[model samples]
Target: MTTSVSEKVYRRGPFPVKFRCLEVLRVTPITPHVVRITLGGEDIQGFHSEGADDHVKVLFPEAGKQRPVIPTMGPTGPVLQPGEKKPDSRDYTPRRFDPVAGELDLDFVLHGSGPASSWAAQAKPGDMLGVGGPRGSLFVSNDFDWYLLAGDETAIPAIARRLEELPEGARAIVFIEVADASEEQKFSTRANMTLKWLHRDGAEAGSTDLLNQSIRTLDFPPGDYFAWVSGESLAMRPIRDYLLNERGTNKSWVRVTGYWKRGHADHVHDSKN
Candidate 1:
């Protein structure tokens, strides 16, 4: 596979990456379609997730099972018990982690009947959720003249974190698409930011070009800019190509990803920056 901008930024880590099992502390709804699950355990003491776009693999147990088969990290890699079936897993952003509280917040998009989604829908306090490494962090410097952040609902957690982390006087232009007007959210940021929200209305998720179309109409600010985008894989391709080929975004400063793929059962959103 070719190296992407994110890979260059994160590289092979000298950073510590460990797998930890977190017990659910609370489950809250952020939106009609988004669930915020707060988890905590002693295992979170040294948890490290420093990037706005960092992700962890969340493991879910088989139906009727009481717990996920959490793996123990071995010298070679994650090691499972003999004859134990591997659990279903999906990638998710670490929305927030409070070391003092030993708590971590992960937001899940409840859009289907998939294991992760189904698990989140009925999650309750005391449930154990297995989470593994972000392995490394791609720390995008906030030193750019301006920034561009775009994505669909699935990308909201990352987008929200980035907006909140920008320093005072920084500039960020954001574009996000959600199901409808009710899905819009307000973000707190010290940066001079402009947010544009797109609505899919009645259109099927991952089947519309709202994000691409919105970005296309923007009169972007001049100067060196860092762009971070992700959503459905195919939906993001043209946008990534546009930034790299048409807008001349420096390959090193732009990051694009496919958070999910329409019609695909698995959600492994790899970067294509």
Candidate 2:
């Protein structure tokens, strides 16, 4: 008997959504403004995150509470318990996940007084936090000749994960904007990478066009490549337009995400490609 073969598929999941209450195992400062909180417990045994940019809705406890109110899994999806006040939650990239060790790492940008930042700032060992639903993962194929990554601090976690996951000899060009030299981070990757760090130097986070300007000056290398651009919502628009309209990049090969929007709390936007 002969079997038919199918083309390789790059995307997976819409996995069952489940909430886990895990304990903070450690907290490390990656940079002056970025914190890495490692969470682990038996509850994380089967936690799944297959994409470099997979995100979990990090649930935070209400004031004076020790643990957040996690939603009960419903027939169709998660449903909040009746009459319970909703918990504060924010979407965060799962920077790393080690299933064997049952550990998950989440990097938080300590900017402003938002719930996630505030929670991460003071998080200590043994503290409990909740995480839910990476819903799905988009696994980009590594067949591209090169890769382009550009964003602000909020995008670092996802970008770093992608870099680390690239096989040796892969080529990647990275542009990251941070507060200053003090906010820059170093990564260990086998891929051939050229990185540029842009400093705001006391300027506002979303007020500059540093990412767009730097990209404009780039002399892109020859070959098909995947491009990932993310950061402030308004800042992402022009960059997306340039890549899609001016450069004539394949729409399906480019992803533009607004990790946050100025003046809007808990805002997350994924621009339509």
Q: Which candidate number would show the highest TM-score if scored against the true structure?
A: 2
Q: Tally clashing residue pairs in candidate 1.
A: 0
Runs of candidate 1 with Cα error greater than 4 angstroms are: 1-16
Per residue, candidate 2 scores C-alpha lDDT tens digits across 86-174 of 88888999999999888999999999688989999999999889999788876777767899999999999899999998999899999
- Top-scoring candidate (lDDT): 2
lDDT of 1 by residue, 208-233 (tens): 98888888778888888888999999
Q: Which stretches of candidate 2 lie over 4 Å from their true place?
A: 1-9
How far is each candidate from the true structure, as Cα RMSD in Å?
Answer: 2.7, 3.3
Q: How many residue pairs clash in each candidate at the backbone level?
A: 0, 0
Superposed by TM-score, candidate 1 places the C-alpha of residue 117 at a distance from the truth, in angstroms, of 0.9
lDDT agreement with native, every candidate:
0.85, 0.88
Q: Can you give the lDDT of residue 218 in candidate 2?
A: 96
